[model samples]
Target: MQEETIKKFMYMNRKAPYGTIYALEALEVVLIGAAFDQDVSLAFLDDGVFQLVEGQDTDGIGVKNFSPAFRALGDYDVTKLFVEKESLEERGLSPDDLMELVWEDEDDDWAEKPSIRIVTRDELKSILGDQDVILSF
Candidate 1:
């Protein structure tokens, strides 16, 4: 019997949810990576933060709102969503403007805990440096 090696995979999203396919494609890749049981993390910087914004209405854009798919990440054990603080501030947005995403901790009696982590640019850089593999979108 051999122990499986889990590599740290980080998906970096730097685009808005709509107006392009980058965001959506990155999301699907994240879910696929999670399915493989690899250690996964998501980093949202620049316009990527917009992907997590709450109350997104795309009727006028004729694009199907995919914000809800973010909430389902926890079900795939894909937590550790990192948002750059400077990016949010630069866009005049705050954590409150984003959707509240959480994951259940089975060890803690299934208690829900936040999955989104707000980090400064320096902090995010350090976190990114620690990843075994990083896929940018």
Candidate 2:
């Protein structure tokens, strides 16, 4: 059997969820990349933190809300979600303002656990340094 080379891919989301399509487009790429069985991780920074914010209502607009897609990432085996603490603070938001996202850990007896990790800006820098490839939006 041929061994598959698993490269570390980090998707850097730095835009707001609505108004522009960058956030949604980045999400589509992440979902596609997950299928290849590569080591995937998503970093939510700047206005990107708004993407995971709870209680999103797109009713005023004619667009369908796609925020729920973040909740399904676990099913695709894409569980590493990193949110920048500094970014949230700058935007006057906290962890409580975000949705509680969980994923099933098959190795841990199929246990459900939170998938989002709130990290400092310095920590995020370290994470970026460790990634083999980074797709920034």
Candidate 3:
């Protein structure tokens, strides 16, 4: 059997969750990409961090709040979620302000682990360099 080439795929999210469809569309792509069983990672920087902010009330705007979808990514094996620290700080948000998302590591005794990773801007640069392909939204 031929071995599947596992590529490093990174989704660069730089837009806000609402006012447009970029964030949601990116998420749909992420879910589909995860099915390929590739090394997938999601980077939330700039206004993209807003997508992780808790208590998003879209009720007034008549939009369905899809923040809960992030919590479901773990089931699809999409676990590497990186958030820029400076972006969060600038937006007055801490990790506590985001939803608690976790993924089960089947290779590591099926242990539950936090999927979100808080990284500095420098670390984010390195992360971008490490990706084989980057899909920006």
Candidate 4:
């Protein structure tokens, strides 16, 4: 059954892109959320930040690169991609180092941001105000 009542949503991806299915699963969830016509937000945290690392090499794993799917986020209207600034700093990464469309501001104008924004964890948790649902991927 489909739920027409969905309003706002935020997804927290908290694992490494490889060595696990979290990254791929999260991407699928984002796609489905968009298909449902609900507002969606994706936040990358912890080891999950690896999903955005630029110049990924998955050939050794014998799997296609999943980074390209991330770039399609905007195409599906799942444009609110977020990254915990601290997470990146801790991992020594910058938004420029990742793949896909992400926000640089709360209103990064999903249609115009050249690159994704880097937000602090506190800022992320705070902005999540009144979301109908929060899913951790």
Candidate 5:
């Protein structure tokens, strides 16, 4: 039997959490890809950084707040969440504005580690270049 090759998949999100379905759709796809044992990572740039901001209240918008779902990504082994630093700066935001996301590293005796990485645009470009497949939303 041929060995299954695990492909590197990167989902690039460039939309707001609400006002459109792009952010949510990309998240769902990321989970599906991870379930297949593929290498998966997420890139949040532009308005997509808003997706991870803490204290999200959608009550006034009549939409269910899906921010909590991001916390569950680590459980699914979808831990690499790369947020572009420039994007946050442009919006007058910082890493402190994002929700705290961590994953348990079993190899490290289950020590908790952060999943979100605040990367520069140049760093993100290199990461995107290394991916086998990149789906932008």
Candidate 6:
């Protein structure tokens, strides 16, 4: 990545950590982007919402829980976090079910918060269309 280049990184995490590598790998990449000072955003849909829920008990699988790591994202300046509203509703979750990890003040009108920006499925698709770089894990 060059300072003169404008690059945007987007991640679509669609699987659960216990069942696949998506969530874990995404987390690692997000951290790496922060280290490199790149612009990055993430969307959680489908089973990916499981990644944000609190009290993730991965003890049985010997993998450390990752939800808490998200709390540290602000320090890295990777602040764009969107969760599809329909995805939460489909999974029987409201924004309240999640921990604060988004642009809360400006996005407060939305039910999803801390800093959540709610989007319909179509909007989600449209945003993905603009991703200069897209990663699906």
TM-score of each: 0.95, 0.96, 0.95, 0.83, 0.95, 0.83
Query: Candidate 6 local accuracy as lDDT?
Result: 0.78
Which residue pairs overlap in candidate 3's backbone? none
Q: List the residue pairs that clash in candidate 5.
A: none
The clash numbers for all candidates, in the given order, read: 0, 0, 0, 5, 0, 4
**What is residue 45's positional error in candidate 1, in angstroms?**
0.7
Candidate 4 at residue 56, lDDT?
A: 89
lDDT of 1 at 75: 89
Candidate 1 residue 48 C-alpha distance from true site, Å = 0.7
Candidate 3 clashes: the total is: 0
lDDT of 5 by residue, 28-82 (tens): 8887777788889999999999999999999999998888989999999888999
In model 2, where is the ten-residue run with the lowest total lDDT? Answer: 1-10
What pairs collide in candidate 6?
A: 102-115, 103-115, 104-114, 104-115
Question: Can you write out model 4's per-residue Cα lDDT over 72-97, one digit (the tens) per residue?
Answer: 77667676767889999898888778
> Per-residue lDDT for 1-20 in model 1, tens only?
24498889999999998889
User: Between the candidate structures 1 and 6, which one is better when assessed by TM-score?
Assistant: 1
Task: Kindly report which residue stretches of model 5 are placed more than 4 angstroms away from their true locations once superposed.
Answer: 1-3
lDDT of 1 at 132: 96
Model 6 Cα lDDT, one tens digit per residue, 1-137 = 46777678888877866677778878988888787666787888899887787667888889777777888776676778878988989999887778777433334563423545678899999888888998886
Q: Which candidate would rank higher by lDDT, 1 or 3? A: 3
Candidate 6 at 31: error in angstroms?
A: 0.3
- By TM-score, the better pick of 1 and 2 is 2
lDDT of 5: 0.92
Could you tell me the lDDT of residue 66 within candidate 5?
86
| lDDT tens readout by residue for model 2, 11-125 | 9999998799999999999999888989999999999999999999999998879899999999999899999999999999999999888999999999998889999999999
